[model samples]
Target: MKFNWGNQHKPNLFTLLFLYFLIVLIVPLGLFSAYYALAGNTNQERYLMRQAMNMTTGDASTVAQALESYRHKAYQLSTNPLVVEILKADSLEAESSQSRKLYELLFTVMHGDIYLASANLVSNSGKVRVSTHVFPEVDDLRYHGNDWDMASIINQNSQVSPTASLISIQSHRIAENGRQVVASILRRVYDQEGTNLGYLVVDMYADALSPQVNSDHVLTDMLLVDTKSFYATSLVHPERFGSFDRFPALNTLDGNYTPRSLPSDTSIIAISPIRGTGLHLVGSLSSAPFFQSMENWLSAFSTTMIIGVVLALGLSYLFSRSIARPIKNLAKRMREVEQGKLESREVSSAISEFSQLEHSFNVMIKQIISLLDLTREEQAKLSEAERKALESQMNPHFLFNTLNTIKALARLHGEEDIYTITVKLGKLLRSSIDNRESEATLEQSMALIESYLTIQKLRFADKLTTEVYLDPSCKHIKTPKLIIQPLVENAIIHGLEPKVGSWNLSVRVERAGERISITVGDDGVGFPPDRLPDNLDELANSPHVGVYNVYRRLFLKYGRKLHFSLKSKEGEGTWATISFPDEEAIKEEMQ
Candidate 1:
């Protein structure tokens, strides 16, 4: 069970196009939609939380300023000489007169601010001497211990300098309202001799100290929490007082303005600290409005994503079709060519590359058809030539008889060299005129070349020299008949015949790796540098018929597999080399 990739079925262009669109267009759009959904909701939540914090900070600042003003007034009243004298007076009349003066001082300091509930002056012994509200009895003042602790107030005053003041703010229950929450500011009083006398206590409505919500954000709520006593003033629920720790979320925030989610409701809380006061301002808002807007945006985003996917799929189909149709037509034409139809057909396309490919394909088919017709004509000519060659074979016997007669005459005349030269000439002629075989062994081709060169040696007399070296390993390899002899003839006629000095001609054959090479070299007056032909056609038309014939025969037999080249310079020797594959490889190729 071997897996072949060539045989694997491939997905069609349409399915591939759809998948590409789904990945590149639809997936990204879906991811963007999800990101927008999450990010949009988060941004809205942050914006709403920031608004609530800003409102809470403004309201806290205003309330803090009002509380600070009251604190300063309380300090001034405590330092008043008449108020101090009233606390120190021994006689009832003197106390009453000083008390009247203290009341008038309180009136001057309060200036009819409705937030101030009452202002009272109490002695060191825990007795209220004068008050803007009804004066509480000593026992009553003590019983309302949480409202104003006289002992602690006196002790705190005693530790302070006479010229300075100590102020304390606390949440207390008012007697008249039966545990209604109020904030009290108590400042220490001093006498002329710097004696610690009593305290000036100012009670303010806690509602006045609570942060106010602006009209623009009525849904928002602001709360002021006393971190020390755990008391709180809430804008949303003004009645909520006492320990704010009951709500664990607000309690856990400390005093930093960080927003947190509340478990009790769909609201978020942000707390900010008031500077110079141990109070935290908390802002809270519901998440309903932000959620509504996010829902609407998600709906619109989903609709847009759906439309985008549809559009992407449609465009992908059109794009893939534009590319696939031309390719399919080209493939169909190629299949026709595979079936041996070499007729040309036009395939036009708008794309530049496709148009060029179509033109090249048509031109290629025309060239193939032309080449096949030429090949058929050549085969007909070759068959006619073979018939004529068979008819001429009877003439070789007459020539062989004449060469034998010449050999016998030379022997009778006692000229042994002439007889030997005649014998070699006979062998060369026989080899050339024979047409029974188109191919000859390397041994037979070399023997034919040796005989031809022997004839040339006699013609040139003492001026010509020749060398023939053939490797024993390549002696049995088959090659075209008369292939080597023509090249040797060309060297003798064109190279050695015209040379003045001693001419050298060498023929060598050897195996080079997987190839066999036959080389013919000559030192002679070479052809003019500019007179060499560029191709076989030009060479064939020239006077060098032997070289052209050998080249044409090798090309027809082996095509590009035969390596043949001729190189010469004007004054240097010329070299001709013919190389072909080893015997086994050549046999395989021929088969």
Candidate 2:
């Protein structure tokens, strides 16, 4: 009995092909995808960094002009005739009468200035004479407690050499509306004889200094910060108003920086000084959005590679078994024939050569073929389902690539409008695709809608006016991502675009206690008065895509807690409002 060592087993086929497929397909593709995604992310982040810097400078200049104007206004208040008379009063009765006149004058100064929290005339004795709000409460020490000194901080921070620049805006807690955080603009008031008469303190809502020019939501956590004290005006993040030293990474950032040298983990910051204001317009862009698509692409591609490798292993095993099994059977049959028993042993296969071996073998071949056919049918169905899923995921990729190509062409020809539109389109796609969460912060939803409106505004130019008024307080409340967007889209598309005259579209999110109301309205061609559906569920069959979709999704997500309404008149415009419990509000209640 001799044993053939070489024929013991041929381990080459399955193992070799498995390694070959992985090495040939998976390794190279993985490397290429990783490298491509990394490079793409880097380039994108660099571009954002440059754009942020440029925007930061523009914003700084705009703010500088505004602040300088406000400074002149403050000086005007100090020199006003009524203000002077209040300081040079003949007696207590005279001062009292003058105070009333000055008080009325302060209200006049703040009449149309919505940002003016208060205009206080602080006397030399540190007594507040008159203010836009309650004069008595304005002088209360309880508000500016903790021994906070107005004159000390102002005198120390004021750069009065060239001209008296109102103390660069400071984070002041005044006794207006429960001592709301406002930026203080203090100017020295004087009598005719040059006797100093306290300071004229004009409290502007911190929002005045907060960044609002950024239509591109790339920047967040913006601040107009004092260089000396780091007292920041953070409208979006009010808690960050007092001091920024708590944010180690944020505080230590240089006078300015770009993403080129920034670490991946740190925020890409752009800073520009507001001239003569002693403050810097600092804006931060998180690395998340810039690199999210790349990370997602790599993760998805890796998953696909894994699936392919697994399928390759199954294929390799099938090929190996198909070739090795039948040959083993044939060899055994030849050994039996060598013993003079000529009948061939049965074998099963789909190979052409084995089909003619024996009748039973042919029958077995037919059964195997039928089984293979059934398997292939099932496999086909699975592959189809998988392909559809892939197509759904690949849609954004195709559209995004197309947008990039269009943007390049637009830039080449210097088509500013087209380029801007394409850039915004890309932003919308990236924002939608990058966030996979079913729920998002209200602020996130606002950003997405804002991006959409921006493109539409560009298309309409001056003919269309869009205003987004968001209660800074409700920004963090949770909501469905596409919840409010479709409504806004409907306003511009269905309500405004078809109108005969100038269109005005507004999206307002107002917080009322624990709940919020989201309203999207337009002054354009509206549906007939009777067309406004009382029930959105019944309108599933209707043509109102935006309102219907929003209603359905919100109803499904929030059940009866969410109330969606649609109202319109043919001559007037339409208003779609969705009101629901603020998740944060509910949580607070529970707590």
Candidate 3:
């Protein structure tokens, strides 16, 4: 009701209200706008980059698995009985018969993968003996022409070996499907006597090794790089195959492709190698779209600020005191939060808006604390899993050599029993090799144990007798692998093998009130009480390394809940028992 609008000398309510609005809203909004225009974009880009890299990691694993599947196919081709018989054929009748069988086998392998264009058993003499694709007929023989210069490619490969295969970066005609197969996986097949019978030539389509990356990304380029020859083939663009000249940023053609910089427009580049093979996946994401998104964001910010300013121009005089105090209080609390003071709580105001803001802030703090605790637990679980994995590893080469020897001996002596034992040994070795998880069902652990004991019983003949018993109720209970196997192994190796006469070993798994108990005992020589290990550290230095590993893994997994007892007396017997609560019991305890 006052007439202050005409006077410029006296302090007016409009001017004071406008000053308050500028102090309370416009200054802070200006800072917020500047941060959004600059630092916010930088942080968002980094976050997006991290997300893209995570996706790249997953796609890399998929590509690695695909390449591994190809390697397995090559192994199957090498070990096929028909492949050897074809090399040993003495007459045209036998050769033709074996060739048909070889063709069928190749077709079976090729048909499983849609991208496999052809699979062939190529002779050392450059003859395409058998092929999955239709071989052109030249007079009476199949196509003998080096249509893809297959002969020169074979001889030029210096890294083809019994253990290592060579991948060539060359285009092959896919006559059947009319699609181009730009690369070949060539593996040298050799007999047990080290005789090079022939090699397997598997031609795959250009996109066979391509990781089906997210379409959100601008481009994904695949390079098939031979692990031995350092040959790289670009799958996305065929003309750039086998050379890094087109990619000047990467200085070398080697598998270790660490590029200093890629194309200028690429915001991020992720490089993942197809393990155990000659392929590397290179993913390029462009920055153009990110810039476009920021442009839209800026436009939205400008519109929002314009609306806020217009509303403030009209409403400042009415509610300046009501809005400014609550906002300042919230700002103070936020600053405390920024300084790591999560306990600071602001009192609710008489205004509903400020009261609601206070309530939401408190709820957000509680959620943050809850998430931190959950993250810590997950991180701990991950560490334990990694430890379990490290403990399960062994020198795979030793396992392979031992199995190959057993297979060779079984073939030479024509012993079905030895072959059966060899097969069981393979199962045991595979179980140990393939245990990537931290825990297994009680039944799976028992199966691995039975396989081990079966092999032992076959080896010891009349000298070993082993019994394994499991309560029917405990089959589905979760237990870590290597928990029972090492104990069983110790019972057999240290308990029975050194015994002079026939010895007996027994394994019993039964459920106690709220826990599962596993006992492995043997009627064999026992360690002297004085020589026994007192704790985990001493156990590591003792002869029972397997026992040490089991104890360490269990203690790390179950913490204080693990119950282990190792008792033995000289000339009596050795018995080791481990008991721990099952998953349900543990969950109840946690709750």
Candidate 4:
């Protein structure tokens, strides 16, 4: 028996075609299928989050409705005229033991829970006539200590109207134990002519409110934080009192709704404010499940991808021996090219598709070499052009002599102001022309504005008062040099100088994220409504030279990301806004 290399060398076209179909079509289709699978999983996760948010919001609405219901019932019981008449009768006199009669009647009629701990009547003379809860002592009936506080509260609440009303956290004494419970809603009992008789207090219990948050199990911990004392009604035990400054839920706090990290290793929080009460209800839950779902999805996708890649490799090998041999030869040739040996190697195959691939490879190698030579020539041309542009701009000696001659001529005329102005102008122009850099720190721009204002002040005199406000954090921020001066010049010459009263010129710099804005405003007669341009081209036109120049410079520096806005009213004031992207924005341009 002998091995035959001649039989192995034979090529088949159909097998080569099948393997090519698998590489070019089937493999890409598999990748596309995987991408859509991942996308579907992502959408599913988002949908689940949305459903959770909706459920949480629904629970919040239910709680609010319950509180409203409690408030309405309390209001109805508090303002009943019969209740008021009895309390007023008790206040009038002892009246043959009639006070005791009225007390018993009141207790009998308004007895039982009614979802409240107790409902009671109190008189203006600081007496608790009757209460559903028993009195611990005679002083409890007196209620003398709470009269001033409760009366003041009743007097100030004007929103409480003719029928019934709610007071915000009424301070009341529960005479039985003198344990003060903060009441949420109260009603004033009045006479027929609306004279102050007494008040009916509906006592809601601290423990009774527990049912308001029945879905606490859904979240890790649910809490109610009152803005008044920053106290919690239902927080994790032992740490429920005082401000929740250190609570894990506070980490999730944002402008209103925030996410906070919990001490428990696996929790995340979502917090939102309760309306009217100014209390915040925070819900903390574990994110491990959400993350685990994502991980499992990815793991499944990775398994699928591995299966697909293995099937593709096996199919490429199994379909045709002739196609596999040519591919192996092509890979060897690629390795030769990678090793800096680009001399083309011939591939022998009777299969048409494999033969075509061999021909294409030879053509591609020749084209790549041609492109390399062309790229070298283009690089040389770009270098020469840059060098010539640099050389054409140099004439420092002639520039200095010309500046000196101008200074001499201005001084000879005895125009001291003009001479001083020319000197500063020359220095400014020289720095601007020589620096050529696109960016400068805010300090440099501030110095430029100060110098420009000095010259402008000499011309405008007492007509103008200038103000500059810059955020301390923006001191190191880089901006275009002389950017602010152009805006100030526009405000002074066109907006302020022509007006009467105080010609106020204010410049402000505000930094936010990867953007900075400089605003220059003036309390001057503003632009006529019809004269303002309708589009950006008009804003950057020659008619508004100073504004236009700055606009153009900002456009060159930051492109579409640099925003410009102008607002002016007929007689009130004018504002010119210049906004540009920061360093982070510059990096985005590269990408």
RMSD of each: 10.0, 44.0, 43.5, 32.7
Q: Pick out the ten consecutive residues of candidate 2 with the lowest summed lDDT.
A: 255-264
lDDT (CA) per prediction: 0.71, 0.69, 0.69, 0.63
- Estimated TM-score per prediction? 0.52, 0.42, 0.46, 0.38
lDDT by residue (tens digit), candidate 3, 473-566: 8998876677899888887778777778889889999998889899999998988987776675688877778888899888887788998989
TM-score of candidate 1 on Cα atoms, chains taken together: 0.52
> Taking the candidates one at a time, how many backbone clashes does each contain?
1, 0, 0, 4
Candidate 2 vs candidate 3: the TM-score winner is 3
Best of the two (3, 4) by TM-score = 3
The candidate that wins on TM-score is 1
User: Residues 1-591, candidate 1, lDDT per residue (tens digit)?
Assistant: 234487358876656766776688778787888787768767777777676667667766776776688778888888877777667762235356665676678888887753445667777665545666664342233555445554233333444455554433334445343323345566867776777677776666655554344446644566666666556666456565556665555744655444343322466666666655656677677677667768987888888888888888888888878777888788778877887767787878989999999999999988888889999999999999999978876688778888889889999999887998989988877777667899999898888887877777787787888889999989888888988888887887887778778999999999987799999999977777677777766787788888888888888877888888888876667889999878596667789
For model 4, the superposed segments whose C-alpha errors exceed 4 Å read: 1-49, 91-120, 124-126, 129-164, 167-183, 193-197, 205-216, 225-232, 235-241, 246-248, 254-282, 300-591
**Per-residue accuracy of model 4 over 1-591 as CA lDDT, tens digit each:** 244579577655556666685687566757776675668555654554454455445555654554565566556655666566666665535564656665565555445643345565676565535566652232233544535443233443565565555544333334354433333455677777887766665555543344455345555555655545444434323224334565645544533444222223455555555555444566556656766777787778678777877777676666655556787788768767777676765676888898899989988887877878899999999899999868856666567678778789989988777776667766666667766686778777777777677677777777678888787767787766677787887888788767877788898888877778889999988977677776667765457776777777777877888889888997888998877777755587788
- lDDT for 479 (candidate 2): 74
Model 3 ranges off by over 4 Å: 1-14, 90-96, 135-153, 170-177, 215-242, 248-263, 318-591
The all-Cα superposition gives candidate 3 an RMSD in Å to the true structure of 43.5
Using lDDT as the measure, which candidate wins? 1
